[model samples]
Target: MSIDQVIEQVQAVYGSWGRETTVAQMRADWDRLFGETVSPDSSQPVDADGVCAAWIDAPEIDRDRVLLYFHGGGFQVGSVRSHFDLMHRLSAAARCRVLAVDYRLAPEHIFPAALDDALSAYAWLLEQGVPATNIALAGDSAGGGLALSLLLQLREAGMALPASAAVMSAWTDMTASGESYQTRADSDPIHQRRMVLAMAGNYLGQQDASDPRVSPLFAELQGLPPLLLQVGDRETVLDDSRMFAHKAQAAGVAVQLQVYDAMIHVFQQFPQHLTQAQEAIAAVGQHLEAHWPPHSNPYNS
Candidate 1:
């Protein structure tokens, strides 16, 4: 088996470590596995009076350019703690401070709650005098969907759009219409078909799955910022990214879709020891930096 398979097996083991395998149990195991993340340099907690966020500074630190980051946990279990290390690497490579948003999760907060928090955090950054042109948004898995949905909301509100966005393994289609959900169902190490359906049910509650805000894949994609979408060939949501990219292209959006062979969901979070993960994240950095050149930013220069 490949190293990715080994990693997936290990994660499957963790998924069963708890007594009942409840959402809480899986969360605890996931926390222990990826939550001991170290934030290099300084990290400042920002409440924005309501929205929870943290600023993970780059190794050299740049305040002018910012990346609004969202964490993935199926929209049910992740936090800044779980995605801190990934944000640190992104900040270092992008040469900007990353504002990691701690948005509300599902089954408790439901549909628009997470999206609300994300929009508020972006608004808060603008209130902080950060230029929208100097900021970008990024996330993985559920967080990736949230990031894209937020972009659509911003467009709907007639607000200034961010410079760019980078999404990793984004679950954009809540309807689960994508072919990969079946084609790669057995192959995807994480995100079982049944479990994902259950998670979606919990997140959407009485809401319609086709609501553009709920499943961004069905949303109108016009006039959004440039987008960088990366997904693993082994991802069950592979078609989620592919279909979304096609829609974005149809809408005249500049979108780059990169599919990594033999990788699993959100592999960029493993940049510490995984070569492909490192390259993927560095590509994210390159995408963002190309939009807001590192040298042009006085703080990074």
Candidate 2:
């Protein structure tokens, strides 16, 4: 279907019409829209230090190479199950096992809690003999922001970097300062400025919103590994991706920024009905393959 049609379908399925606003209900809806990968090749739960996580495996996936994923839910709701299908598909497409992290969410677990879980997950991978070169960090929305923050923390700590990273419609600005929030206010069907601001507040708690750790848009982007940044044109956070790309490039980080025209946020997650979504996912696989290469994977043991 065309992008407009895809947007309309997305609106029908996910729009705010009669949608419950409570956290409990929001979570229930998220689960229904994107259910678990019940029949994935394998799904194993794990303990990452104090964090909870799981492995989403697919057939023919490279054993050594792994895609470490963080789920997005405004840092409030979302779990490994909530994003299992996306992780499983990413593994299948990238030909690598996916470690879907169940990072702590906000209100109870605010800023740095989720980031801590992400770092802990990455550290767990390293401690498990998973070479940093064989791993990649990925997430959508808030998770994407966490991925970028984790990279900065890792680099600052002198830790070895992952092979690459991928993010989808990443909400990089905690301040909701992007122009798209205003310009795309009516066109974007998924997000709004006030809502995003509240979500950011929920995640930040007493933390500084402008801190690079909280908002990667304000982060020092130098020395990051290759990245695949995808955002939809119809998204209210469109400027997040656009500004991030320009800054990342200026920081000498190689980035492949894919802006799908007329599409809404996280459109890649709707591959079941959107062909563009599938194609976008395929591009992720190609990007990962180029960086890690097949067969030569560290998991080839």
Candidate 3:
């Protein structure tokens, strides 16, 4: 299928967000869309320090290494079931197990709840005897921002950091102040400035939009792990990834920013439908594998 066709189908489902659509209905549609595409036969459910999660194991996966994944839905909708296929691809590509977390969502859990759940999952991994150096963090959209937020929280708390992290179409700025929100308004059919701000409002409520905990784009980014940021040029929040890359690089963090022309938000989620998605997801796997601890690197073995 072409990217245009994929976009059209996505817009069909996502376009109902504000048009008399309840959150429950939207959640069901979201899950049905992605869940129906991939079966969770290989997934093993687990309680990660009280947080709902699953171990997505690749065929012949190296159990020693893990890819901790968070799904994207503006922190309101997506789930482990929705992203099972994506996590499976990531697991196979990196030859590692994927710990996909079902973190608390917003308007009910509120700010800090998602972050707390993510932190709990990571800590649970450490407690399970997985070395910090053997883990990599990844997420898409809001979950991407949440991954970064978890990293920042870990760093600030003087905790051991993961080997590296990556984000695809990361909504790093809740302020929605990026220029691409306007520049790509016409090109991107999936999201707009109003929609972006509305999602932020749902997750953030009355919390400060610029808070580093919510907007990693506004945070002090020094001392974080190497980052791979993948974003589509046509996305409304394109600048969110671009600006975050610029800031993270200037703060002395290693950053690789790949901007795919004519792609949309979280395009990697559609590997079965788009060529760019295939390439981007493969690159993500390579990035994580390449950054693992030298002795534990799967490729080296």
* lDDT (0 to 1) per candidate: 0.86, 0.85, 0.91
List of clashing residue pairs for candidate 1: none
Better of 2 and 3 by TM-score: 3
Give per-residue CA lDDT, model 3, range 76-133, as digits (tens): 8999889999999998888889999999998788898999999999999999999999
Cα misplacement distance, residue 131 of candidate 2 (Å): 0.9
List candidate 1 stretches off by more than 4 Å. 5-14, 17-19, 37-42, 293-301
Off by over 4 Å in 3: 17-19, 294-301
Tens-digit lDDT track of model 2 for 1-301:
6667766754665565353477776677677667744454457988977789888877877888889998888998777767877788898898898888888878888877888889899999999998998999899998898898999999999999999999999988888888899999998876999889988998888999999998888988999999999998888999998999999999999998999977788887778777878988898988888887457644442
Query: Which window of 10 residues has the lowest lDDT sum in candidate 3?
Result: 292-301
As a whole number from 0 to 100, the lDDT of residue 25 in candidate 3 is: 89
By TM-score rank, best first, the candidates go: 3, 1, 2
Candidate 3 accuracy as lDDT: 0.91
Cα error, residue 94 of model 2, in Å, equals: 0.8
Residue 139 displacement in candidate 3 (angstroms): 0.1
Candidate 2 versus the native: TM-score?
A: 0.92
Clashes of each: 0, 1, 0
Ranking by lDDT: 3, 1, 2
